[model samples]
Target: MYLKGEDISFGYEKKNRILNHVNLSLGSGELLGLIGDSGSGKSTLGGILSGYINNYQGSVSMDGKKIPSKGYNPVQLVFQHPEKAVNPRWKMKDILNEGHAVSQDILDSFGIKKSWLNRWPNELSGGELQRFALARALSPKTKFLIADEITTMVDAITQAQIWDIVLDIVEELNIGVLVVSHEKKLIDKLCHDVVFLDDINNV
Candidate 1:
């Protein structure tokens, strides 16, 4: 399967354009990188691709078909701020299992202790919360993952560990990944091929 975005464009206001006729594609099992500066609309494009933002011009499709409007989405997005992505009122276990029954193997791979499941979102550190976020996003139904600077808030060691586990899981599942970030070094290290936002975004 492949995810393709063609002639995509969006803006917050009429006069202030962010993305302009950008085109991108990612095939299953392909690790693609999208590199850009802050406020360059990389995250916005990720949002559009993952079906979070719907006001954009042009089209986003998977395997030449429109993404489903209901039910579990094959394209899952893991944001930089995992805290913002989850509900604070819910416990970690509830949040983790909100989408599907996250397997014991996945929890074990992320080093998510059973004890952590009982704690609130605020009780865990950013890195710990991020592990849960990733674990949750990488469900059996997920076909493509759009990771938007997911490890930006974590330390170097934690970043490496998270990526290693994620890479393994995606490979095993043949899930395509779009790694969006400002860090060129990180992109170079993780992706099979890299697309600079400047090169694709007309605006």
Candidate 2:
């Protein structure tokens, strides 16, 4: 397996478990959809898969080795709110090349013209910023991505365009993506397989 999580359970108080025995497995090039209601542990599960929350009961592994919670690389997450995920003061170029290599073509693919790189994050509209965020995440040596409701902020047309760019990048890089969303249509459109969070035992 490329990445796997088994019997994972977590909550703030040890006794109150928010996630109940969640299990998931992903191949190197799989795009898996995580669908659930608003507070059904969708973002929480994304956090676990990205190694942000490791205090859970069960096991999570990447490339068959245990996942390191602190300072872990190779995984990235794009949150639902671009403003929350991105640094308002930083330029798009800075976000992409933040001590890492980034290709010019990747920016171009996200509809970011060369001139736009010099502009701060605040200058771009929400849709543009989200696209840049996606580009930055894809710029690194990211093997897996946890996309947490990445299209919710944009209009329908922009969402379609952004999804296309993401799909293209994932195909080109052969990356695995855990796309978390409440939007069933998007999940059906992008995912190779779907994991319904409501079905905790099966997940």
Candidate 3:
């Protein structure tokens, strides 16, 4: 497995558990979706798998080795709200040029224009900002992406466009993706495998 969560369990309070016992595995080039109602610990699992929540029980590993806390690459998260994810002070070009190779074709596909690259986060509309966030996350050097409610703030047209860009990236890079969403329609459309949080209960 490229990524796997083994019998994981965790929560804010020591005695109160949000996720009971969860097990998940995804191989390379796979696109998986995790869905459930709010407070169902979906994002918590994302945090754990992405190495943001380390105090949880069980473990997360890549290629059979323990996933590192400090230097591990190849995994990145695109949060629901782009405003929350993006730095208001950074311009689009500054964000995208952080690491990944940028091209006119890539920008065109995400409905972004080269001319807008110099604009700050607040200058763009919500959907545009979210697309910029997606671009930035995908811009990094990585083989796996955790898209956590990536389309929540965008409209239908923008969401569809973003999904297309996401699929294109996954295919072009042969990357594994774990798309966490509460919307079943989007999951059915984009993911090859679906993992429902309600079935696993608290982990």
Candidate 4:
């Protein structure tokens, strides 16, 4: 399977465009990196690919078919800020299981404690919440993952731990990943190929 974005273009307003005529593709089980400056619309492209933003031009398809608008999205997106992505009112367990029932093995792999499940989102550290966010996103039905600077807020040790577990799970599941970040060293280490947004985005 493959995820392809063709002639993609987007703008917050008519005069200013964030992305323009950008094309990108990722194959199943492939690890790809998207690198660009902080405000160069890397996250916008990721959002377009993952079905979060729908007001863009061009097509985003998987295996030559349009991605479905309803139902569980196979293309899952994990944001840089886990707190913003989840509901603060919900307990950790409810948030973790919002999409589907995550396996106990996945929880263990992410070092998510059983006790943390009962706590509120704010009670846990950013790293802890990110672990749950990732665990939830890596559901069995997920075909592709858009990781947008997912470890930017964590320490080096925590970042390494998170990526290690994520890489292992994605490998086992054959899920494609698009690692979007400004960190060149991390992109070089994790991705088989890298795409610079400036090279592809004609804005």
Can you list the residue pairs that collide in candidate 1? none
**Residue pairs with clashing backbones, model 3:** 9-203, 19-202, 19-203, 20-202, 20-203, 21-203
- For each candidate, the alpha-carbon lDDT, in order, equals 0.95, 0.83, 0.81, 0.96
Q: Let me know the TM-score candidate 2 reaches against the reference structure.
A: 0.91
Candidate 3: where are CA atoms >4 Å away?
Answer: 99-105
lDDT of 2 at 47: 88
Lowest-sum lDDT 10-residue window in model 4: 12-21
Model 3: per-residue Cα lDDT at residue 174: 80
List the candidates' TM-scores in order.
Answer: 0.99, 0.91, 0.90, 0.99
Backbone collisions counted per model: 0, 0, 6, 0
Model 1, range 78-179, lDDT digits (tens) per residue? 999999989999999999999789999999999999999999999999999999999999988999999999999999999999999999999999999999
RMSD to the hidden true structure, all candidates: 0.6, 2.0, 2.0, 0.6
Which runs in model 1 stand beyond 4 Å of their true positions?
none
For candidate 1, which ten residues in a row score worst on lDDT?
133-142
